[model samples]
Target: MTFRHAADPVAVTADNWIHTSVLVLNASYEALDEIAADRAVVLIIGGAAEAIADRESYFAIRSTRVEVPLPQTIRLRRYVYIEHVPHGGDQSRATLAGVLRRDRHRCGYCAGWARTVDHIRPRSRGGPNTWDNLVACCVACNTAKADHTPEEVGMRLLWQPKAPTHRAKQQRKIWRQLAAGHA
Candidate 1:
């Protein structure tokens, strides 16, 4: 509810609210991103966005001029243009965690749960740490294919690997809806 400060009744401590996540929506009510609660409050107080939903239990953020409820979801007052940026292209460096997430934690060789990543062209032979060269692998598969290319071990990949696509299509659809302003 209302939090009062000992020194100044109008000031609320930001420390407690900094970790809370607030969902952000576009002007057209399309989901965009999640940001910290403090940032959401700033956007709301600055008149850049309005709170669409508040936390069930109210947490008051008090300032000299105003006191506002902490927001759970906020929508921008105006549409914000988003440019799609490609992530981790073939030549770009790939992290072990990123490769695992891209493969859905499934082994690319046997479709089993994976805990590690394997280089398609073994790192020993100078495989670059790129999206196309890495795949999620189970312990057994990684051991079996150690320091060797898939073909050398007579192993076949379940699927070809590539860089993950961004949310370009969904963003485009949201832009179209914003333009139409359909009821």
Candidate 2:
């Protein structure tokens, strides 16, 4: 698809195009990230990147000085180095906020609204603050569970907890492609 901005061929409101997805490419033309159309336009105008592909339906973003088409894909003008961080393991400590977000703030036992976190294996018994050991819990469930393990209290867990997977595979594939191109 292509976009035209000259003479304002068609009126495109910011509200209509702001939510559009724009694929971002690194300076080497490797996929980097996906960002909103408005942000992409800002990057393009700021001279940090240039549009590689414009949307098929021409949408004009007009200014007193110039106009530009909404971009479908953009490439950075300079190479950006990003440091990779390893995903946390089962032994890694988890935060209360992280646990709540992972469970979508729903009780692990009853699927009710959860404002607190529960330890599957009681902390008193040496349960670590790891992703696999923590679960979001409602106030009532937390009180009932006390310092006892779920098995001991006869309360079955609705789901087994584990460390959340980051986009490692996708990132590896992109890296491989970049390596091959360099070779």
Candidate 3:
């Protein structure tokens, strides 16, 4: 989306499309980092990283290619191990709500207004309740989808649920602060 900048006479690419950020997590359910929405789109389409967002958009990056948010979290084809960045508690694996907040409440099922989280494999089945195993779930959907897999419940997920990539949660924090503007 384009917007006219008050600071400049020329229209500028309002970071709106890129407003949403993607978090990349390690296979171990660790907070690795974050990526811009555009870059995340690239990774999702090029088959590098699978989208963990419940809802993804078909963003026209540079008006050339389109990206798809994988319904499941994807691992890199090859192991290019990076530094393992630690998040909160070593034993405290992030909850689905925490993951959703980290993901800015974007649905891991549809990228819609998500206030709840869904365990991909269902906690009742020993799903371990980890970040990679969970995604954001909206209230009505989550209620209707209690203890059932997407397939079993007849709901399709938009993207895959994987650990976040490590970039700069700081960047997201910065955005939040900027948006809040010292309120």
Candidate 4:
């Protein structure tokens, strides 16, 4: 769409359109990643990809020699391999930092800001440092439950401990594919 003053008709409706997310698919139609709309357009214009779906309400972006309807999804012309990164899970080793991050620094017992992680079953009792056994804890709560399970301390956890849910974005393989001209 053409850029104009906000009050002008047919103006660029969204100043942040370039930052809009566009899903990218592998040539085999497997899902790959979400990329910026601008990048998707470049891929379309450069003949590296094809639009699979257009944006809702029919918005379009124009450059000096090309005008492409903004895309909601695009597919690469060539199939590329994606490597899956091992993700954190309930049984995975839970590091102090990872636990705090997963819990968003909120104590599992009191829902207060947490600076540490506590073992649901005290380490001395053979608690493994796994996601299922750890919770973010404030200094006070940690001290109060020291060397004891929540049941023994008569404290109840506000939330269950678990691994954070995050999609595994592909990495490293893109470079290799590009080097081999398969991207």
Candidate 5:
């Protein structure tokens, strides 16, 4: 469903279509090419970019209190560029769900049914939730390991999860769209 700012002067009607997951990029900053709208909100909320003022009035929605997408490009507190990062083999970012699927839902430990996730290094011990440190785990194995380090628990991982050398997630999405069209 499309959402609009409560304070918007112009109403968004049936003619205007909205799509989620629109990508935003850093135009000046030497960072990754793009991020999702949700992440863009974080950057805006964090004072990284001023909403492109020229486009604000034309946005699909407007709320004085909350952040809304500007209809026009806004200048970043630093230069920011917004672009649709196409899905392809070279892209680095992959969704959590995609990572889990790549691992085939198998616990690095026991290899039984896995529905949960485990950190190779416990978070309490300072593990960040990146793809390399995460693995699909069964409930039983997770409970068995608990908050302790793997060495402390005497458990061993069957495979070391690594970041993909090539971006498979984008390829997968393209495949899905292609398959859907054929169907």
Candidate 6:
């Protein structure tokens, strides 16, 4: 079923409110991870968790016997032990969107708004798509630097490209449970 979630001036009609995100917190008020709305509701109903913060807009989900306010944040009654997992290393393969996000969509050559990724080493010369070799480039710079290294074209990189830092450990998952395929 759908829910009318007023995002702003535009009302976003989501296909499934059950899939909406709810922040899950440990008993000590430590943020754990995001979980599905349905699971959060189950936790609240089963007395495993309680709603710490309700949705900004007053909305209630009703059952035959109870009406629980939809939550933006929920806290568990018992502390959950979560372990950190290594997200990725510096040598990880890079994608176009990832490159743009890493560089904030600014041209590596001119620091202008960018929408394309350029290879420091041209692909024709066997440059693999890796984080350290890719940088965001604007249309003009990309076209001008076509098939040529920046030095050969007298252009300079604004910053050295590198893989993005990993997210905080707790945001990933329970390492042991995930490794054993139980989480």
Q: What is candidate 4's lDDT per residue for 18-102, written digit by digit as tens?
A: 7577788999999887766777788788788899888656887898998899887899888887645566433346789878878
Every candidate's lDDT: 0.78, 0.76, 0.57, 0.77, 0.57, 0.76
- Candidate 2 residue 122 C-alpha distance from true site, Å: 0.7
| lDDT tens digits, residue span 12-55, model 1 | 34665666777889888988977667777877887878999887
Q: CA RMSD for every model?
A: 12.1, 9.0, 15.4, 8.3, 13.9, 9.0
By summed lDDT, the worst window of 10 consecutive residues in model 3 runs over 3-12
Given candidate 4, what's the lDDT at residue 58? Answer: 83
TM-scores for candidates 1 onward, in order: 0.49, 0.55, 0.45, 0.54, 0.46, 0.49
**Candidate 1, 165: how far from true, in Å?**
0.8
Give the alpha carbon lDDT tens digit for every residue of 31-73 in model 3.
5555555655555565555555433323334535653542223
lDDT of 2 by residue, 1-183 (tens): 243342344545666677567888999998887766777787787677899998777787775667889888999777766545465443336889878877889899999999999999989999988899999999999999999999888898899877654543344444455445444
* Residue clash pairs of candidate 6: none
* Candidate 1 similarity to native, TM-score: 0.49
Q: What is the C-alpha lDDT profile of model 5 across 61-171, one tens digit per residue?
A: 433667466333333454422345554233454455756686888888899878888887888999877777788889999999989777898999898887653434443
- Once superposed on the true structure, which residue ranges of model 5 sit more than 4 Å away at CA? 1-96
Model 5 scores worst on lDDT over the 10 consecutive residues at: 17-26
Error of 6 at 91 (Å): 5.1
RMSD, candidate 4, Å: 8.3
Error of 2 at 23 (Å): 2.7
Q: Which consecutive 10 residues in model 6 have the weakest lDDT in total?
A: 4-13
Q: With candidate 5 superimposed using the best TM-score fit, by how many Å does residue 13's alpha carbon deviate from the native?
A: 58
Better of 5 and 6 by lDDT: 6
